[model samples]
Target: MTLNWQCIVVDCDDPRQLAAWWAELLGWRLTHAGDDESVLEPAEGSPQDGVSPDMLFVKVPEGKAAKNRLHMDLRPDDQAAEVARAEALGATRVDLGRPDDASWVTMADPEGNEFCILRAFTPEELATLE
Candidate 1:
């Protein structure tokens, strides 16, 4: 049997604040919270079939330094719009050495956690994934 993906834990100085940032960005609901931890699940009718991993932000004393070892890539319906919206919400564009014609933009969340915003894929293009 294959194991299911449950959650992605993010390390931050303030879990609640980071959780709120992600919840608003992804339109996810806050599922649980504690003094040093917070959890968020995908919104109703989101791509989750009850199996999508939730996002968990946990408190840590250390601040983010150097580049991220792992990062998320987001495919939005309108890349530019989403980028603008996220920027308004404290996200920032980052230089990751991407080529000018690259279909994605690197960004950092409020806590300087890097993630990418990729152009939406067409069905035909997606079919090639399999």
Candidate 2:
């Protein structure tokens, strides 16, 4: 048997808004926007365009009551700068009691969806993993 992963469905109060926010944050293309659902995809012709899964935001009446069981982990070239940019885009830092020296920073989107920003590996660190 074989399977294909199509998209990750996100439940939000406003699908359009949340989808737009994520599209901007990840630089993904917004392929569809409607009242009940919105979708985002990797840029056309990019390596991940068809290879990566899409994000599908769907409207839901209930609010998020707890931390997400599954979340995204993003690694950027500069951790601090990326975190700052996320804040500028309305994402807030979340302290989930992780240790101070933790390699990842927790954050929440405008609709309180939690995701992590992992620290980038230094050149020396990358070489060690090779």
Candidate 3:
């Protein structure tokens, strides 16, 4: 038996704001919206429409206190450009380690979710690492 993953849900103080920030960062589209919830899915006509799972943002009362056990690792086609773009969108660098490393940059979302920005790697590079 196999189970399929649907969406990655995140608890946030403001679902709409967090959803908007993620949607812009990933170039995704808002698929569902409610008073206290929002969902961001791959853009229309995107090849990831069926393969990638949507992100669900839910309203929460408490704030995040510690590090997240699970976090996203984003890979942009252009690392430098994407980092600048994310910074302009209000994401701040958290400085996990190795700020000079060209491989990846760690950043926190508007709601303080820590996620990494990975440089685009080719299939060969991925295989080599594996």
Candidate 4:
């Protein structure tokens, strides 16, 4: 038996809008768009082509009421720049009482789903791991 991850589904009030926002942020293409859901996948031939799972944004009736049990943590080449870009695209910083020196910054999407932006690994630090 084998199981492969397909996609991460996110519940939002407006699937199209939310999906568009994410698509813009991640440079993913909108593979499908419908009344209730929108799907995004990395562009063909890109580094993330098959390794990264698709993102499916589905419409829901109720607004987000609590913190997300499962959230995404992104490691970018430049954490501060990425966070700023996300903010410019309508994402807001979220405070979960983390330490001031925490290596990750918590942020929420337009619909309030939380995700974190982790600090970039220095080349020397990455080399040591290998």
Candidate 4, residues 1-130, lDDT tens digits: the string is 9999999999999989999999998899999888799999998889899999999999999999999999999999999999999999999999988898899999999999999999999999989979
The TM-score between candidate 1 and the true structure equals 0.89
Write candidate 3's Cα lDDT for 1-130 as tens digits.
Answer: 9999999999999998899889988989998877699999999889899789999999988999988789999877788899899999999988655547458898899989999888888889779978
Best by TM-score: 4
* lDDT, residue 9, model 1: 87
Off by over 4 Å in 1: 126-130
Residue pairs of candidate 4 with colliding backbone atoms: none
TM-score for each prediction? 0.89, 0.93, 0.88, 0.94
Judged by lDDT relative to the true structure, which candidate is superior, 3 or 4? Answer: 4
Best to worst by TM-score, what's the order? 4, 2, 1, 3
lDDT of all predictions:
0.91, 0.95, 0.89, 0.94
Better of 1 and 3 by lDDT: 1
Return the clash pairs for model 1, or none: none
Better of 1 and 3 by TM-score: 1
- lDDT tens digits by residue: candidate 1, 1-130: 8988889889998888889999999989998877799999989787673767889899989999889999999989889999999999999999978899999999999999999999988889889977
Clashing pairs in 2: none
Tens-place lDDT per residue, model 2, 1-130, is 9999999999999999999999989989999999899999998999789999999999999999999999999988899999999999999999889898899999999999999999999999889979
Candidate 2: regions farther than 4 A off: 124-130
**Model 1, residue 83: C-alpha shift (Å):** 0.6
